[model samples]
Target: MFNGIVDVCWIPFAGFISFLIILSAINKSVGVRKAYVNILLRIFEYGRASIESASKENTQSVRENVTSDQNASVQPVKDVDANESTNGATLITRDAVLLPQAQESGNDKPQTLKKEEFNFDFENCLDYVKSGVEAIIEDDVTSRFEAEELKSWNMLTRTNRHYEFISWKITLIWMFGFAVRYSILMPLRVLVCFIGVVWLTVCTAAVGNLKDGNKKRAIVNNVLGQCFGVLSSAISAVITYHNEDNRPSSGICVANHTSPIDVLVLMCDTNYSLIGQRHGGFLGVLQRALARASPHIWFERGEAKDRLIVAERLKQHVSDPNNPPILIFPEGTCINNTSVMQFKKGSFEVGGVIYPVAIKYDPRFGDAFWNSSKYSMMQYLYMMMTSWAIVCDVWYLPPMYRQDGESAIDFANRVKGVIAKQGGLVDLVWDGQLKRMKPKKEWKEIQQVEFANRLKSD
Candidate 1:
């Protein structure tokens, strides 16, 4: 009975994988392939837009309510002035200084008015009125704009439901398909990857023993790394170069980080020296091996003193032409490919032209992101192996130079903006360390304060 059930499950799983392979082949041309992918991506885009619209509406509604409440609170003051005028009594200004209006008396001379001063919160009242008017105008404009956008996308929402249902069904089939594929291919893939790593380690160790110069060893290591990348099925890289001449021989290279495979993708293309925090577990072994083969910089991220030392070392490395270009992920941590976080200013402060690289992955076939916090290195590798393929796009943008009076922070932000724009990623103002823990409001405020202080000290 179990064998019969297993056979039944495998039938649809096998069929789905076959279907994907056929689709992939049909869309082989880059232009056709991108258009086809965009068709599938429309559903996700519409869903995201709807969510944003709803959020904006909610915020506007809250502002309107607050404005109304403030107006209600102020209405009584206006009523008091109206009542005084109707009764022909002394008019009291907001400051409580009474101004007596002239009244006809039996005598022609007007009676002297008593100078009674009342202390009303006139400044507070004016402030409330000004804020209420601004809020009302802003809320009305935003609400109208969001409503128009939502109306334009009405047809998309209707059409998206049909495709979304189909996507869900495909997703279910993909889950089963991957499970069966992993069962069959995981062991072999592991063995192949292990052998590849061991081969590189042995070759690197040999070079170190021979006392070859660092530059020579680094070039050889990079060639080997490319071979390993291909063996691991990182088969295709769609690169867009902004300025070919901007590829510097020795300077800092900053890139938006996505996955561990990023190292392989980059090393396959250029002989760049990497700088990162020390890793542990299986990855740590690879890091230690690579360190022997090249003069890469690695430091403990949590240590303030270690960071200062790293800054000095980076400056020294960039000064030497014999050294390869030093690569740094200035975001300090990997983020989901949808967004790029704030860039750390240490690399920007090195005071040289910096090259920015933008990387994006196509999730239509397989997701290339390695969520290291949730999955171990081995698990992530297995996942990658079981997927259909890993496809990526890398853009090497023009080198950016700091302006005459620009601070390092401003320079970093300018570079980050260009990279984010080219990469089709949202630019976020979040600190990468937010990934480690959920921050409370107090924590966020404290972090901002610390960042401000650090800037001042710099």
Candidate 2:
């Protein structure tokens, strides 16, 4: 009797439980469907933003801005072919990228010139102007470096010039300083090492601390750049420097990046911080450690992070009165020091008193330039001992503040032009002492060289 009673009541109760489970399942499915729809909406919004940014890349917009420069005189393009223009049958001087016209020969152009001889307005305007940079020394204008001023040695002289790094006088001074800091004096070697460890730790944090998302742990990496310049100075008697108004506060700083010493050289002037990068191995770990202790920032390259965060952080630091100006090598990579490399964009973005620096090495230690490519820390140090001194010029451009609607590329071009004039590297910076680098032609040259080299025999 008890079993029969239990079966009758439990069956109805079990039906109610089953009904509740089905209802809950239906609710979850609806919730998931709504969440997916929300995701799609967000994706659609991002696509809209992408389309808007792409619109800015159109040439029509750039041409419009190009047309409005009122200060320039109108120069007519002589003998331009009508077929190459958008107006079809009419030559559009502005539409064609500016190139120097072939000079007229005695045999050409028999007709006498009339003021309206050509119908087209000649935009003698250049798409990219390559001139040596003008050097500034704190409003105490020293002269500008002319491209003609730089006379190249089919090679720079590196004769039997011997160098003595540690003079007996300096040696004694170092000994005294070392003696004062000896472990015997304070037993602080362990503590100093620990401090280094802590400094490294802080360096790692600093890498990511100020970066906008795309930045690598680059602070330590940048600070380390100073080592190369210093090494160059160690070998050569040329000591080059330029002042930069890095932050908007007091001023900015810019210098020629001849070696790792590029950063060190700037540090000599002010206690500025660096932007660096982080690696994945032991070296990276070591760099990360350095970042943790220092006021450096490390960011991984290609990391999908918002760089605006880092930019804002730096902006705040620069705004503060206590911080020194920010310093950066506009030429992102180290060069052979004969000429300047193409300026990268970030250095131009920070709004402040803008200064352009032109750095060159003296013929002191060209081999140090060699070690710049293949040497590790130990190798670099060894190379430094054997060779590496520099003769360099530091040219500072006038300070600048960010204008409305400026792009990094434009700033790079402008600043590059300034530095080229200042440093006398127009010929050397791009292809070395032959012809100046054309702004648009530079990429084309690389492409052409690659294409031509691809078919070469082994």
Candidate 3:
């Protein structure tokens, strides 16, 4: 009886895998993923409405109790005239302190400073307190490392708002979602991902045996793209590419990094030689497989001469026009897909056509960011598999070249600004590495110097 049940269950799983393979081979979708996303949106909408109604009722009850308590405990203050005096002291109205407007509205004038005794007032410290509070409310660096705040809960408990237990209706919906994600979706996704990786390894190994030529390169590119497509579908990735004409053919392709899947997303459409530190386990398998078929630069993590080796290899790769572009994320770390952070200048120093690609993931569907400090790779993949879907947009901007008299840092910032603007992301000057390390001593010193200068000026 158990054997018969297993056979029956395996039928649909095998059929699903076959369907995914067909989709990957054709490099097209029949709107199945789109339809799935629409269904998820409708479910989220229902949950949001149910949670809002419950919350409104709860808030109304609390407000009523608070209003009665305030009425019982408080007394009204006596009214006082703003301009009236008491005990020989005159009270000034706010209007009395107003200054007259300047007659020359179109012209600018410097204000004359009235020198007075410099007093150390607590009010000056209040500015610091306000800034501190603002930082606490929402900080640039820390918030970029956390999961994005959802306007409505996406039936996931891994968010700030806990609306799963808001109502019996929502609770039942959440339980159903949990069952679907854990019992059905995750296992299928894991199976598909495993098969995709195995397929990639086998195909790339066969392609690697071919003699070095254009034909071999062509075969490698096609195989890698198809394999990446299968892997992306494992997560139900719905990526829309913009400006396919600007897709990177050669030179270096630099993009803002949000997750390791960023490579998988882009590789589904175009093939690029990846460059990064070599790793072990799951990523190691993919890296080794990719390097066998293509000229990817994977260096040892703590090699003494890694930088020079990478620089030399990078120049040699770009010098050959026939070779694929080396994909790079010059930010050096992943960020929550809300902002573009300071990019490292090393990649920009290389003289070649720089292809800037912007990737923006719709967090409403699923958060694509990998907070490396908080979650391990396996844990993150688990979260991704259980999420509703991965929906994102990739914008390939026009190729850029370093202008005359522009430094590498300036060139990098220019590229970062363009990406941030195109993707509607906040352009931040803070380094992404701040997630892993403390701010540099020089950075703190610079702020200290600025504070001292302000004090002197005052």
Candidate 4:
């Protein structure tokens, strides 16, 4: 009975299934059928309107040409008659009799000129139409190109700075690289890491909450650190850590800002009390989960009072031996791994031992910079997963205390200098938030000069 049913319906069913799958894939990348239909309708309307406009212009030009031709022919005839009548009495020779005919022949020259002018106008109209059509076609092409580029996994992938133009062969190789990384390894790694993270976070939180002693909390912290180590290993194809022994056991740890993975890399080695802004969306979920596992200070950056509270909390966290060392990215925002932006003074003002950690990545593997404004969390993760590998170098410098009379701003800059030096990154004086809103051209040069002058004076 089953065999008979399969023979009767299998072919059609298979075709229908294939059609549905294709439609689903298209919808996933380019939105639903209705959106595409609307886009097609818009294109059709624009083309029709352009055609109508061109036709109207052509018709108007034709009518003008016909009117001009009649005028040219009639005016020449009238001029010939007038000249012949005016000169009739004065002219008696054969040459004189043929003068009107000669004048009429000369009038043909003006008619020829009028016809040439009409032809020129018609050509101009045709050129106008051609330009309009070309513009429309270019716009369509550009929109389609952008749509396809967005569909690709490498939307925010940075171009290699060393090489501007890449060959087709190289492009094909990268395409294959993306296919293998995203299609196969990425999903498996995500599933395994996510499960490990959830289990570890929940257990750590439960144990820390239920147990009353500092020893148990410390143990949980170690386990959480190990979990991150496993995660980093799972996601990164190749990772190398330097000066791991230099990591501070306690007090404040400040690092240069780069990717979201910077925190993961730091956590993999050290048990630190994180101090950062309270984030929303999927990031907020991770923040909340980690906050449960440990006493991480998540503050609302928009609230002035909250900022003050965060400073006090940092001070308190660092002073407590039972708590993990406090970790903060003093830059407050991620810059392109090319430079270290000015550090915020809040973390530095806590007035304690500061451990500066420098982080740098080899772009030959993959870029670790998180372009948050351009990409969502999932998109960023996909980019990371699809790359060849994420390779990083971590440098831990000696701890520094505030100089006897040094201000918070000066202290922050000094720390930023150390990190930037160790990481082999350019030191920038512009505030990250300001740079984001205005742009580099507006303030970068002026700020750099001012920073240089300040440095020279000091």
Q: Find the candidate with the highest TM-score and give its number.
A: 3
List all candidate RMSDs to the true structure: 18.4, 30.8, 10.9, 27.0
Off by over 4 Å in 3: 1-5, 67-133, 304-306
**lDDT per residue (tens digit) for residues 20-75 in model 3:** 77797668788889999999989988877777677677766766787787866444
Question: Clash number for model 4?
Answer: 0
Give the residue spans of candidate 4 off by over 4 A. Answer: 1-172, 301-306, 438-458
Q: List the candidates' TM-scores in order.
A: 0.58, 0.41, 0.85, 0.59
Candidate 4 C-alpha error for residue 117, in Å: 63
- Candidate 2, 403-438: lDDT as tens digits: 678666566666666666666553222322122233
lDDT of 2: 0.42
Worst 10 residues of 1 by lDDT: 81-90
Model 4, span 270-381: residue lDDT tens: 6778877788876787787777667788777676356667777778888887777888887777766767777878887887799899998755445677776777888888
Any idea what lDDT model 3 has?
0.80
How much lDDT does candidate 4 score? 0.60
Evaluated at residue 96, the lDDT of candidate 4 is 14
Candidate 1, 1-458: lDDT as tens digits: 99999999989976854443333323232353345445435644554455445556666676678778776442211111111211111122232111122222213432333344544444535543554565454432112111111112112222123322333444454445446446755544555556557766776676556555765756565545544543343222333334556665678888988778777767756667878778897778777777766678877867545656888888888887777788888887677666677788889888888988888776543556666677777777765776544567778888889999988877888999998899887665556655665544544344344333333321
What's the CA error at residue 312 for candidate 1, in Å?
1.1
The TM-score, computed over Cα atoms with residue i paired to residue i, of candidate 4 is: 0.59
In order of listing, the candidates' clash counts read 0, 87, 0, 0
Query: Candidate 1: where is the Cα deviation over 4 Å?
Result: 1-176, 183-185, 211-222, 234-248, 301-305, 437-458
